[model samples]
Target chain A: MQKTWNNKAWFLVLPVLLLVAFSAVIPLMTVVNYSVQDTFGNNEFFWNGTDWFTEILHSDRFWDALVRNLSFSVIILAIEIPLGIVIALNMPKKGVGVSVCLVLMALPLLIPWNVVGTIWQVFGRVDIGLLGHTLEALGINYNYTQDPFAAWITVIVMDVWHWTSLVVLLCYAGLVSIPDAYYQAAKIDGASRWSVFRYIQLPKMKRVLLIAVLLRFMDSFMIYTEPFVVTGGGPGNSTTFLSIDLVKMAVGQFDLGPAAAMSIIYFLIILLLSWVFYTVMTQSDAEA
Target chain B: MARIDLDHIRHAYGAKPTRESDYALKEVHHSWNDGGAYALLGPSGCGKTTLLNIISGLLHPSEGRILFNGKDVTNLSTQERNIAQVFQFPVIYDTMTVYDNLAFPLRNRHVPEAEVNRRVNEILDMTGLSDMARRRARGLTADQKQKISLGRGLVRNDVNAILFDEPLTVIDPHMKWVLRSQLKRLHRQFGFTMVYVTHDQTEALTFADKVVVMYDGQIVQIGTPAELFERPSHTFVGYFIGSPGMNFMEARVDGTSATVGSQSIALAYAPAVGGAQKIELGIRPEFVRLQREGLPVRIGKVEDIGRQRIVRAEFEGKPLAVVVPEGMDIPADPRVQFDTSAINIYADSWRVGSEG
Candidate 1:
């Protein structure tokens, strides 16, 4: 009741507060505002609480895109996490080969995402491209433009090519930080190769694996630019991830309400799943 | 248990090791009796760990061979050599329980579940980790995790020898004593041939029946702790073994007397100093007694260290230390007498003749 008020203190934090409001809070609030309302023409809006949300939840197009997003993320994680670990493990631990390998691993990561999409789009053309023509020359039916499965495969491979290096770099960082003593001790313990990986390498890499899983999951789920540039969500919506569908709904069809609502849902899904992934991965660390 | 022999073992980290200086370990020829405990004591980068790694088969020697009970195991892997090693920092499987960590070595060889259980339980009990057997090994204190590391080695009954490379460095001082005594007890209880490597002299002297003192990548002397204190085979051993270590002075020898500057001290044996480029007198601080009469010395400082008073002095322009028991009188004009029985003469850093 006797507390003195010094209003000048607010001035100290005003810049950061305004910065956050403009960059993050404002955009997020705009999405939330649009999510629960109907907007039409110049500055006209109507209260439509939860209607857009229900519409988005009920749409088949949304569900299919969601399923596609989930499947793509799962498949990529299943392949890339283990594959990245294998590659990192096999990479030279020292000598001149180390820098060479590091530079090569970083190469794919340095290319712009759209450039990656463009590279694969041109490279997968059956008539002119090396890979496509080589496959055709090998008597295989490979046409990414015409077949849905081929398009999905092309997109998956493209994503893997573009982003597996992130996983490799992270895992390599985790691997190299491990002191040499663990390996020496494992060797002295008569541990098999599998046991060493399981008991030493895997446990040591847990933190990085968490970041890897979260990054790969979130990035792959919200993937838009690369596949959009490459397939344009063609072959009858086979590769239309949530981000692509959201873009189509908002920009192509001019359906702002559903897109904004879906955007909120998408953000929530990422936040929720990331929490789950983080908790599941890091729970043992807390116990330890 | 099997006796282990290292035959002229030498190792160099670099491939093009043409000079003696290039070798990380130089010509270590030694043997460990079956069921004996030995410690390799040396300064950091003096190749104690390199020699330990070689014995554990983690490093193959550049020259020479290793034998286990007369069987050549020079090229064998550590697993094949049946060795267990604990590292400087405790190396526990961070995700595994203490029991499972202890059981790892035995399980790796596909030991029967019952036997593995029996052995794991025995080791857990022996290491006093039975209370924490179910806890994660990674979550325990450093010393507890080290106990698990030790248990993993001890769990395997078939190992040729178990080696420790400064395994107690991460442990707290009080726990270091607990673990050292535990190790000593384990050595007595199981009679496992052990080779411990450390820079700590107290640990070496207390843990090993014979301490192998190394200097400059070479084992200079291997002897009982008493022999190392009484007569160091090399000047390095004398300098590295005791609390403040042995005090050595540049000297000249003739008959039974060794002359340091203008002071002549009687020696136990007359070392033949023929053709020797350098001659030195080595004596432990414990043997240098301060009395009212003898060679003149100027007392510099007296340090009271609980049970012993280390009298620092200068004799013939050379600094010396004398360890006098607590409550021992220090004369206002203090001079010193070197224990004639304990005085060792060194020529060119090596012991003169066979008195060592």
Candidate 2:
């Protein structure tokens, strides 16, 4: 029997397309308009073609922030992936303990982003917070607000605590899916624990780890909430990342043309990096 | 090739088993000769896989020792045991090429590069995967992936014993047959001590020289294929080993005669019944002869299975199956005669000694 072709499915997606166009496209067009033109009060506007883009492309602030974002993403990925895998390996595979461990790891992830920042802000205080108080009692001058190194450390640690669970979860799923037979086979082959992890567990976790890296990179690069709340891009702007600076330019100084151009450039950078990650990781699978 | 001795081995997953009933594997003690192919045959939840794991050093027996070539290995890990295993489903590195997968174990042991390549190629050729060696294992069909798993197990000749845990369960029917025959050939050529585990009777019967039939976590019988078929030590063996299983009829033994219901049939041997416990007569469908003149039976239905016919009927109100040769006319009046010497008597679900 010949099947009837249904065109009604397109109708289901029309609303989503309209919603995206209204919410995303119109704002993007407004940004594009701002990017190419300068506006004063009373709706007076002057055409400024490619000037803001050229200025952003040549700015040291933009370059420094881009470098900072790249480095942070790389460092976070380097620390999180291996740490996640190790923790996942040590986790109980079944029974009551599994649920407890899962809940514990998931606790940090469930907290709101703003709450996470607030909690860290208080917790890292030199006088009131437990961590800072303990470090002071130990005679260490640990103040995140005043020290660039402290700010960087706190940000990295916070990112690790909040996001490492994602990697652990993905790795755990990969680990659990492995049949007992592979371990048996590994045992029969007299494989060392390291070899088993390297050959079997690591390879099996490739696809999940790829996802973890991409997600962590994207989030770390675009991080604005926690660090902004904690540092306020302060202490001589030492902790000022791209998002903080973007907000500073767009909202603090109200530099519309330059900020819009900067925002577009930032979006393009993230898009390009995410696309690279996806392409490189999936290329081998596609080729095979 | 090495002789493996299991000395009073027992295992439990948790704490010490307080009773014989508490153990998953209840005191298995057997020694398999070098180069002899054996199969651990049992249904799921019967602890066959547990026993295999213990033998492979994946699990330590709570009681007794495992000896490989008269040396104790009870404290060894699976790696130290030098045993290879193939699992039920394929356990291959999906991202690696088939060649790399087969070569991984060899490289781990620091085998020379040229030698690794030579042996890998030989194994790939043997497994009929030479054409797909360079291809990644992820895209291969299930059967092909399983073949890679099998090849990984068989690649290293230095291992003491190769254990298979229902490895062919996921394989296609035709591939199962081909792989079984190929494995049999590999075992013969290399003289490896191979122990295959499967719940399927056909695979167990066809692949191994000796079949160890287990039930409820105990090894009920270990014998050659013929011995298991012709003379089963336990009622479970008789029931589990054959298709259509062994026909059992509740019986009462008196001197040289056995009575089924109200009909008394003469027995070749007399079994002593000490108590009012139940007694049964066990016979295969193949041995129960259908005739025109004998004990009357109510015919139920006939199943024509190509070369033979299975006459499903009731004898003396007890279900009985009789295998009749094809092309033989079904008599309007159907009767069955038990081959006297082929009869087995059981007491309380166990075979009893009866003088023949």
Candidate 3:
């Protein structure tokens, strides 16, 4: 017997495809159009052919921002991953204490990214902010507005405070999902506390940790709102991440053609990095 | 091999259990012989697992001492106890190969590489996992993972005891039988003190040399399968250890006869009762003889279970199950007779001494 096939199923997904086309694909095409062309005011466009791409590829500004983004992501990950695991380890397994700890950790995650930046901006001020005032009173000048080191400290601390909760939550979920059986097995094996963490807890948490790493990396790499609101990519562009640079080109300078090309480059970089992370992590999962 | 002694152990989760009834495990004092296979069998919320955890040093007893080979290990951790536990679910390192998972404990103790390999290989052979040694643990079936868990527990020769808490629950039925037999073989081969915890009566009966039946918060009975079946120390044991559990009929005992709702049944021995109020007759379905002439019973349903037909009937208004031969005919008026020699009398859930 021959089977009848219906092609109308494709129509069911048409709305979703249209939505994606409008929101993402159209915008991406516009960026691509701008990338290969030169535009002047009064809606005039000239085919510049690969000139913007070549310029962006050779530009030191793009490289510096990329390096800064990579370093920031690496540092944030290095600090957050282990810290999150440790926090998760120390958390109460069961009872009201678990709920209390969860709520407390989630408090920062609930605050919008821009709000987090605003809070940190006010809190790290030299004159009125408690932390800055206390540091000044201790005979230490901690002004994030003017000093590069202070600005870096402020940005790093702000990032940690805002995003560490995500890592914590993921690690916590992994920890909670581990049946008491594993711990029991570990105990019976005469496993030392460190060995238990290494052989049992660490391996079990690998999947979640990978997610936390990818999320933190993407967020830190594309960091614009917090640093822009706090330092305005300033104290001599010390805190100017890739997203900040991209925004400066696209919005501040308003050189639409070059900025659009830069935006495409930025988008490609994120897509490539995220793809790499996903592939590596998922491949390891498959191997395991 | 070491003897484990639980001395007056009592535990309560909350602070200061003031009353005698406040304890979760009420003063369990028992001794298990070296290299003995014991099963702690009970329903959930029966404190069987709690006692096992306490014995494993996962939980600290609120009161009393646990001695492993005469050394007090009540305050010690599970690592100090030198015990290997296989939990209900398989707890293997999913990222590691089966060989690596088995080799983990040995390597952690810094055992020689060749020796670790030899031991792991031997365990893999024992667990029927030799073919899948190089395969990662994550992709294997559930039962296979459980086998890895068992192998991990059994790999360490220096451990004093191996504890299993419902390790076969996730296993398929056929696999469960094979594993149980394998475990029995392992126990005999290794001569390790093994304490198995399960709610399944068949598993406990087949696996353990001595079964510890728990009820409420106390150890109801601890004996061999034969002893548990023939002479259950408590009513809970009589009810728990059998498939169609022992039927209890409320009766008035007088000399060598028990009157069950005006029907007098002869007993081999008289019930010892001076002030005992609630006397009950306990008898298993296997012991209840279905004869043509005896106390009248209304047969309600018959279940033909391959080997035998279980007759579900009402004897003097109380439900009773009688196991007869597979091809036996159910008479129009079936009469059941209690095997006098096998009958057990109980007073308030505890077995009373028989007066001959």
Candidate 4:
């Protein structure tokens, strides 16, 4: 058989390439452009060689925000992954309750980002909020505005309330796909409830748990609007995650070079972490 | 091993079943002996699986009691029944190695690790999976996974009985034969009371000491393969247990003869079918001898199936099949004669015994 090379096929990909360039590549190139150059007043620009990148890397503010983001991601994954699985396990397998439960779980995800933040902002106000008033009436020092610890708790709780449903929904999908035969066989084998969960349910839900963990990690790591609106990065920057800090530097201070450099570094870190997660998970899957 | 007695069991899926029509399993009352191998043979939706589940305690019967060795266990859970069942599709722990999978049932009962190891190794060797013992069950082929499921059941020693529900459905044809034989060998060697459920007649006949033939949520007959072949208690058993099933022809029977169309054939004995609503005479295709002179039949199609030829013919405006040996010549005027010893008389689909 003779093989034919068709160079004309490249024409079909032109629309997608143009779309990606305008949407992603072009904007990214502009950031790269700003990162590698310095600008003065009167539209004068000068070439700067990686100095902004080094400066951002050496700054304590960047490291602190990075640490905060990493810690937040770790904490939420630890809580949400197990919590979601537990909830999904307890969910009704059949009957009228399934749709009702699913809709209720999805309600939190449907709310817009800023609205969630606004709801929590007012809901946690020391003077007027129900939660704050209840806590204060119980003789607890509860003020998100002035106390860094309270602000951190409020932000973490808000993120968990908003994003844990994604995990629950994914785990629910995984749990339901397992056939009833496994459960029947487990019962016949005299497996206890914990053994059933560990051997049958957990292994069945592994793929979805990986997906949930990765999604929660990325989303929580890059979370901005909700925490920004609720805490306003106040209480001495206790809850200022990397995205919040990045927005403050880029949009507030208007330091384009440093901000652009930081953005690239943040993108690289996320890409690297996600790649590590994917490889580790899929490798374990293959081994199993 | 324990004798299992299903005493007047009936099951209905509905919460409140008001009538017999609502029942999934109409009724089942039989006792399976200790160390006996039995097969529940029926077509799909015939309540074979429901009966098996009831026996295994996966589903409690809505009526009647179940006894294991004379102890009432009707209210017992499946776990409390201490029975092992392999499902149609292999249900394996995906993350566990094959060894660990087989050991799981033992470990759950808190069996010591040394005993678990001994039993697991023996089963692994028996199932030809010793080499794959360390391999994850998820990575095995469909047949290997099925072997794992079977091995898990066999590894448990204290189980009252091991029930199989179409466990070889997922295996390849060749592997099905191999696994089925392995199961038979295991049943013989261990003498475990086994109840296997399958719709395939060959599987049922070959694997079980007694085949319980079911139809429309009722047991038509329970007998050995030879007895089922010779004397089916119901027309359904006669129809369901053969390659080309029994031929049933509408007939009018006198004391010692049955009239088919204008020809009256001699019977070995007078069947007591008095006041019967319907009368049918059934004889296997093997017993319908084709010859030069008998009741005249118009030949339709002759199918040569390697060892024998199946002559499809119309006998007095009714379809009939006659099996003839290979290379046998069909006479110019072909007809079929039913072996008098093999003729069975049915009254309203139920077989009629001989008169005193």
Candidate 5:
């Protein structure tokens, strides 16, 4: 058999390549360009190699924000993953209640992120908000504006309330795709409820859970909108995540070189963590 | 093992079942014998799986009771009933090893560890999965996974019955034969009250001692393979049981004589069909003998199927099939004689008895 080698087929990918260069590559290259340079007023630039990266790495503000970001991601994943599985397991498998429950679950995910932030901000005000008023009437000291602990709690709660639905919806999709035969077999096997979840439901939901964990980790790590809108990194930088701090540096003080360096480090950390998560999960999946 | 008595069992999927059409399984009142192998044979949507589920207690019938060993177990769950079922597709714990998969049912019931090991090893040997016992079930082929499903059903020693719903549908052709024979051997050795459900006639006829034929949500006949072949109780049974099926023709009958088309043939005995609007005479292709002088048929195409020849012919503008021995010659003036003793008379699709 004779094979035809046509290099013309490479032309088919030209449009996508150009679109990706314009959308992602060019912007990323600009950040890379800024990270290794020094800039003065009037758009004058000088070649400065790795000075901003080293300075950003040594700064306590950057390290503190990174630690806070990692902790928040860990907390969100730990709470949301198990909570999502439990809620999905308890959801109705059939009947009119299925649609109703699905719609309710999707409601939290449909609201814009900033709107969610605003809603929580108003709801958690110690002086005028419903939750804060109730807590105060019950004789609790809860004011997010002045208390660092209260600010952290308010931000964490707001993030959880806004994002837990994504995990729930993903786990629900995994749960529903499992055929009824598995449940029937489990019942006939004399399995207890926990055994059914452990062996059947959990195993069936493994892939979706991996996806949920990865998505929640990345999204919560880079989170700035909802928390900033609600707390504004208040109470002495108690809830200032990496992105919030980066924006404060770049947009607030116009330190483009250091901010670009910090942003690149943040992106690399997320990429590394996500890759580790994906590989570890898929490896266990294969070995199992 | 226990005798399963379905006492006037009926099921309707809809909440308000006002008419007979609403019922998925019409009334089934029959007792399957203890330690007997039975097969429920039917086409798709014929209520076979519904009846199987009812027997396994996965479903609660809309009407009537199910009894195991003369004890009413209508309200019992599948676990309480102590029945095991293998579904059409293999249901395995993907994270477990083959050995662990087989041991799952026993461990779920809190069986002794020693007993679990014994039963799991025994099933592994029986299912030819001993070599793969340490391998994860997720990596195995479909047939091996299905074997795990069957092994799970067979691991328990005290189950009331083991129900199989088309368990061999996922296996390859050669493996299907091997697994079927293995199942038959297992049935012989254990004598469990097995009720295998399938749409294939060969599987039902070969695997079961008594084949229960169903059509349109009703059991038309329940008999041994030979009995079903020799005497089909309904026209549907006659059509569904055999290859090329039984040949049916409109007939007018009086005493021991049946007039099919223009020729009148003598019957073995009188069939009491009193004022029935429709009458049909049915004979299997194997029983339609080609003779020198009989009702004339225009021979169309003769099919030589290795061991036998099926002569396709037309009689009175109706197609007919006659099975002839290999190398038998079709005479110049072709004729067919329906074996009198093998003929069945049907009135309104129901076979009429000689006593009637």
Candidate 6:
């Protein structure tokens, strides 16, 4: 069948094309502009092809911040997936309890990221804050401002509280969409409770689980504001993740070329990793 | 291999039932014989599924005990009751292969692997899923998935009965015939006590030895397919069992004879019971004969359905449908005669006497 070659279809796609240009393409062109070009003074620019990229690629500070970012994302994903699914499974399925659980789960998510950072910053003060004071009272050395381990734990815990609800909501949506027939059929089939979850619930929740993972990966990978306010790259850069380091280079030290190069690299890493996750998950979903 | 006795069972979905209208399933005291093929035939929301669930122990009756071969199982869970069920929509483990779907019940019961393999293979062949057994069940079409559901039901030998709740609804019409025949063949081969629920009269009549007709929330009549057709015990059964359904006309009855408007018709039997609030003359289209000289009828329309032509007409001011043989001549003055041996007199919805 020959489809008449009408150029009108591209006209229909013009809005979406313009949207992508504004939000993604135009900004990326600016990053590319800065990445290979150097600006010394007002309106003075010079072509310095790949020099900043090479400097950023070789710098110890860049490598350290990247390692921190990678570890944080991995740890966040590992803790959130299982924990969210467990909470979703245990939440009440019907009546007033469902609304109560949903509202409670959504409460942490509704708070602004900066506000979360401020709340945590004050809440972790060893002199007056409840958590820090309690830890000190318990004869434990706990301080996010001064201790690397404590800072990491505090950041991870805060992230889980802020974002685990998104996963819980996604998984819960998956769970309720399953018709009552499957459970009844399993009961008649003499399936154990664990078998029911393994065979029926998990299989049904696969698609939603993919979305949850991807969303969490993208959000956690690009995380900045909360940790920036809470630790301010903290107690001699122990918790200085990639975003904080990029801000320091760009805004703090005004190293425009290196910061721009590093930001482009960071964007590419997120895109590549997200694409990999989507391809692997959807491929397995298609197979099953 | 068990006789299921629903001993005075009643169910109400509300917290505290106050009246009969509140009940999902009204008091049902009935039993299904071992190895018998039965159909719970009714329109939608007629409590057929509720009854099936009760028998399977997915639901417990509010009023009475249920017994399987005289062993009380009303309080037991569906797993403890040891029955098999096929749902309206196919419910197979999507992540598993077709073979694994069939073997699931057996594996859950911890049956030996060799025995499970043999039974699964046999069911695969029986359901015509042998070639697709290695394929994942998630990718099968609706009818194919339903066949896996049937196979799972058949894999368990220890199950007391297999209950089907309109399992062929999602199947295409052509596949529906094939799957239904396969089901009938299975019932004959293994003689597993099977109770099928369906709103389609053709499916119920063709699939079961006995058809239990239900209306609202109560069973109107329970009889063999032949009995249901020839002598429906209730007006609802008479109206529901036939292809075009039984034609009912307002009438007055008095001992073997019934008067419909101005014309008198002889009944198959005399009613020993007293007169009731309503009396109706019931006769299937098969029993209403079109003739040259009888009570005059105004011919309306004729629908040719392959071998038979159903003539829609008006007899004595009431609408009527009489099926005639194809190529039969329509008389100039068309009139009709009701077969005396087939005429039924119903009083207050119940057929007073059908023995004659």
- Write candidate 4's Cα lDDT for B254-300 as tens digits: 99999988889999999999899999999999999899878899899
The residue-by-residue lDDT of candidate 6 on A169-232, one tens digit each, is 9999999999999999999899999999999999989999999999999998888998899899
Model 1: number of backbone collisions: 0
lDDT of each: 0.90, 0.89, 0.88, 0.92, 0.92, 0.91
**Stretches of model 3 off by over 4 angstroms after superposition:** A1-11, A127-129, A133-142, B19-21
Against the native chain B, each candidate's TM-score is: 0.96, 0.96, 0.96, 0.98, 0.98, 0.97
Q: Model 5, residue B282: displacement in angstroms?
A: 0.5
Instruction: Please provide, for model 3 over A145-166, each residue's C-alpha lDDT reduced to its tens digit, 9 standing for 90 to 100.
Output: 9998999889898889888888
Give the C-alpha miss distance for residue B22 in model 4, angstroms: 1.3
Fraction of native contacts under 8 Å reproduced by each candidate: 0.93, 0.68, 0.75, 0.95, 0.91, 0.86
Q: How many backbone clashes does candidate 4 have?
A: 0
Residue-by-residue lDDT tens digits, candidate 4, A1-288: 999999899999999999999999999999999999989767788999999999999999999999988998998888888888889989999999999999999999999999999999988887899998889989999899899889988988888898889989999999999998999999988889999998998988989888988889889889999889998888888989999899999899989899999999999999999999999999998887
Candidate 2, A94: how far from true, in Å? Answer: 3.3
Kindly give the stretch of ten consecutive residues in candidate 2 chain A with the minimal lDDT sum: A181-190
User: Candidate 2, residues B129-222: lDDT per residue as tens digits?
Assistant: 9999999888898989999989988888888999899999889898889989999999899999999999999999999999999999889999
Q: Report the Cα lDDT for candidate 6.
A: 0.91
Poorest 10 consecutive residues by lDDT, candidate 4 chain B: B171-180
Give lDDT: candidate 2, residue B27: 76
Q: What ranges in model 4 sit over 4 Å off?
A: none
Candidate 5 Cα deviation (angstroms), residue A147? 1.0
Task: Write model 5 residue lDDT over A73-192, tens digit each, in one string.
Answer: 898888889888889988999999999999999999999989999999999987889999999999999999889889888888887888888988999999999999999999989889
Q: For model 2, name the residue pairs that clash.
A: A190-B79
Model 6, residue A216: C-alpha shift (Å): 0.5
- Residue B112 displacement in candidate 1 (angstroms): 1.5
